[model samples]
Target: DVRECLARAGLLLEGAPVLYLSGYKGGQVNPAKGDFVFNCSAIYELMPTDVRLCQPAIFSGKVLSALGSIIAGIGRPMTDAMGTCGKAGQSVPSSGGGNMFLVIDENDEITIGGV
Candidate 1:
């Protein structure tokens, strides 16, 4: 079912990825302006093809939310993100996490924070 969804979005690779990751480990956010900076990682497997693509990508919370909504509308299950927060020499555990989706369509574009 997940593969089908990816296929509809033009994200299904010719071969199955050896690995797939979703969610962030740590990040910062500005509640006043609803802005955030996060460190996220996703590793995909391009087995048999022998080609690997890696790059840094940034996406706004709005775009991420939209994608999550789209996935939910299609009945795909997503895992909740988890991380720990530290501030003022204190460490705190956090439970909130964001839904993640991989968009493979070349036409799928997301705008990050103001340019």
Candidate 2:
């Protein structure tokens, strides 16, 4: 998730002639302990077959899953932190940094810009 967001903001693929960001964060956790921190990257190139669309639904499930795992790790505190336990589980306390970008290729020219 961090890497994907970074790639979108043009922070992760500066030297590459072409780069794609894809997929979601995958990691392990222990309820007795805590969640796992990961360093990752995901890319999806803008191809004729795909419009390079970044849909919210594309990562929604994964986000929910990860959030669920985070909530589960906290156990009883989650019930209080979230106040509910549904399919998506509860929210956890978190903070992070990221960027958003819009990359455009015009006539073989590539322009990397922030979103």
Candidate 3:
């Protein structure tokens, strides 16, 4: 699991801090162009017990598809239904999915889909 990997890598500290578990209902991606946009929602967990809401933000970056491949190399891959997706001139059922864990040292830098 990615969590275990993070722990082994010395990324998961004793406090555990805040962890964001995110899911997106719909999105668009262009593999050739290395671009993506998602309508995402997330759960914010503060260590042992406290749970809080997080604001959604746009995720834009280069090589998103490549990012997925990199994540799979280190952790487990997973897919689940978020809802529906539409792109170009076609509408179809689509889901947003990814690996189990990614550890970021800076909390302020974290961005999720929807609050």
Which model scores highest in lDDT? 3
lDDT for each residue of candidate 2 in 9-101, tens digit (9 for 90 to 100): 454453443334344354333445433333224444443223343332122223333443321111122222223222366545543322232
Global local distance difference test of model 2:
0.33
Candidate 3, residues 43-73: lDDT per residue as tens digits? 5554343456666555444444335433222
Judge candidate 1 against the unseen true structure and give its global Cα lDDT, from 0 to 1. Answer: 0.46
Of 1 and 2, the candidate ranking higher by lDDT: 1
Question: Candidate 3, residue 42: CA error in Å?
Answer: 2.3
Give the per-residue lDDT of model 1 (tens digit) for 36-75.
5654464444444453544434434533443443433333
Model 3 segments more than 4 A misplaced: 1-9, 14-19, 43-52, 64-98, 102-115
lDDT of each: 0.46, 0.33, 0.53
Would you list the clashing residue pairs of candidate 2? 20-43, 21-42, 21-43, 21-44, 22-42, 22-43
Q: Give all candidate RMSDs, comma-separated.
A: 6.8, 14.7, 5.8
Could you estimate the TM-score for every candidate? Answer: 0.41, 0.21, 0.45
* Shift of residue 108 alpha carbon in model 2, Å: 28
Let me know the TM-score candidate 3 reaches against the reference structure. 0.45
Candidate 1 displacement at residue 27 in angstroms: 1.9
TM-score leaderboard ranking: 3, 1, 2
